[model samples]
Target: MAHPLDYLYFSAVMYTSLGIGDIVPTGHMRFIAGVEALNGLLLIAWSASFLFAMMNRLWDWEPCVEPKDEE
Candidate 1:
């Protein structure tokens, strides 16, 4: 409250959905905190899926085999 760093710390906590007991938000801030937590969760899920899709597209998972010699 007294220093700018406090707001930064609060934002970090809210964005991560930590919801620690200390430094609780009041009034309008509570709404912002809830929105931030939800946004963080959605972004995390989206990022994971996007990364997985990208990796799948880039990697080949099939196995390779040598041909048999003719008799």
Candidate 2:
């Protein structure tokens, strides 16, 4: 039996389209790997969007506390 991390690594390779031939899925498992690949791709794209939005918001905003004037 394979560990869960094995599935994750396999999925990652498939998502990157870099199959190394050590872990091959057969039967229904093949469909599962396909789904994982699709999920990885979508998640990566969504992350990119989220990161950009966050950066834009941060860049436009200012610090909460302003510096006090010197005596």
Candidate 3:
């Protein structure tokens, strides 16, 4: 709290959902950590869905047709 680097360190840990246990959050700060973890999860899920949709759209599979033999 005294130095700017402390805030950066806390934010990096919270956003990544690492919860390294080196620094503990108290009171309302705990709520913020929970929210950050949830947001990170949602963001990851959204990214996976977006990538799946993009890949599906870009890749297409067609059934192969065989020619009939002459009698």
Best prediction by TM-score? 1
lDDT of 2 by residue, 1-71 (tens): 99999988887798865677799999998887788778778888889999999999888776679976699
Q: Candidate 3 local accuracy as lDDT?
A: 0.84
Residue by residue across 1-71, what tens digits does model 3's lDDT show? 25888878887887878889787888998998899988987887899999999988998956579766699
User: Which ranges in model 1 have alpha carbons more than 4 Å from their true place?
Assistant: 62-71
TM-score of each: 0.75, 0.63, 0.67
Candidate 2 backbone overlaps, count: 0
Q: How well does candidate 2 match the true structure in TM-score terms? A: 0.63
Which residue segments of model 3 deviate by more than 4 Å? Answer: 60-71
Comparing 1 and 2 by TM-score, which wins?
A: 1
- Evaluated against the true structure, the overall lDDT of model 1 is 0.85
lDDT value, residue 45 of candidate 1: 88
Better of 2 and 3 by TM-score: 3
